[model samples]
Target: MNPAVTPHQQIRATHDAETVRVYQAFSDEIADAALARGTFVSPPFKMERMTWIKPSFLWMMYRAGWGLKDEGQRRILAIDITREGFDWALTNSCPSHPGEAMGKEDWAKVKDASPVRIQWDPERDLFLQPMGYRTIQIGLGKDAVRRYVSQWIRRISEVTPLAHEIHNLVRQGRLLEAKEKLPVERPLS
Candidate 1:
């Protein structure tokens, strides 16, 4: 069952039509940048504009790449980025507490599984949906939250332009400008 999500939460979760388009446009721009930077690679799936991506989704992605030691002091697992298998990985054993730091292998495994999606690429007049789950995991402890915040900053840095645009919109009090730009008539499916 779907729990009641707060308005703020809803805003964070759901992306309106225009927002989806914006993200797609940004993704294409990123792809182009990646190509220019020699980071471009062919991917499967058709990308589409996203209506919204939930915070939980972002949390899940972050958790997958996070390096946490288990009780046995083994290797930390990572979330597999492939379209197959479980979405997370572990290094050693799960940690008893959040104080210990994760090692390189643990971070790589999870970072490799980071989920990135492209909603609608207006440049191509096409939609793309790249696979790989991007999410952050919220833990029960205060320390865990702190770590999550730190991790969140790093992840957001991956999409600097989009992040900056969002921040600017909020700072300029223009986030609601979309309401006026979109047509009032219901869109046809």
Candidate 2:
């Protein structure tokens, strides 16, 4: 079993003791699996009074889950694994969002370059690069895609109810309705 599989789906797993225990168990399971698969373990995490763990990163890792990328450039192909899927990479690594590698100026360029499209380039065996953008390829397939989409569906399910309610309110588009819900203001001294 992939430790990347969420504890929520692990039916046998429980989190009654400590949040860290659940995270630790999950991380250990994933680390073992990653080692077995010969994937590169990320740089050791640094945190105060913490041993190789940080809550925010754990949350990000949880969100990313587990993924695989079959083909890519030297750096990307060296490992067939990722903590998340293609779209996650596209959106998160596209320079539009903050990530490990991309800086803000680069991200601004990508955002402004929006609707940047890609066409499969046989020579590259990957998506063609968008002009004025530095990223070349991004995607996942087979088991990785299926799992990532499944995780996406589950996450969307969890958030959709409240989102739908908000959408309905926005569709109504009434100032008075929004005004009623607005926080009361207090004068500052």
Candidate 3:
């Protein structure tokens, strides 16, 4: 936790020198195809549509219901992508909605031209409750998706089991144990 970071919005993620890990919940078909190819493919994983990726593990678990949300979101994937690509998305992104900084007309024009969209959602705790701070959700459009699939991804892993394990711990009131299982996420510089 950096002292300079405000409690409202921050980008915290599991990352190393070259790559940052993002979470996405997908169907079995998409997961299988992506895992097999080590990247997303067209047939199962649509390229023309927007894909949202989350850096917060607990927030992902909350959204996907610990990998038991639905068949469409049954498989939880931990994707390690190049920091360069992640930074590119951030640099070219527009806010998902209009903010005080911009009017709707100007925002609409910017969003239409940008390939990435950003949204800040409430972060989650070990028990999957919304925290005071917010985490980022990056939505990739066609152009950004092209870069992500062709040049960004380094590793793809299935973490559905880990999700269930942590969920079980939390359900049993083992806060420390569950917290220990979480990925070490630090504020991205």
Q: Which tens-of-lDDT digit does each residue in 90-118 have in candidate 2?
A: 45333225556888877678655543222
Please say which candidate is ahead in lDDT: 1 or 3: 3
The pairs that clash in candidate 2 are 95-107
Model 2: ten consecutive residues of lowest lDDT: 69-78
lDDT of 3 by residue, 1-189 (tens): 333455688899999989999999999999999999999989999999999999999999999999998999999999999999999999999999999999999999999999999999989888788777899999999999999999999999999999999999999999899989999998899
Predicted structure 1, TM vs. truth: 0.24
Look at candidate 3 and tell me the lDDT of residue 23: 98
How do these models rank on TM-score, best leading?
3, 1, 2
State the C-alpha lDDT per candidate: 0.25, 0.27, 0.94
Per-residue lDDT over 51-110 for candidate 1, one digit per residue giving the tens place of the 0 to 100 score? 122233222222222112222211111111111111111121232222237776775564
Residue 29: error of model 2 in Å? 30
Candidate 3 residue runs with Cα over 4 Å from true position: 1-6
Cα deviation at 128, candidate 2, in Å, is: 28
Each candidate: RMSD: 17.3, 19.9, 1.7
| Candidate 1 deviation (Cα RMSD) | 17.3
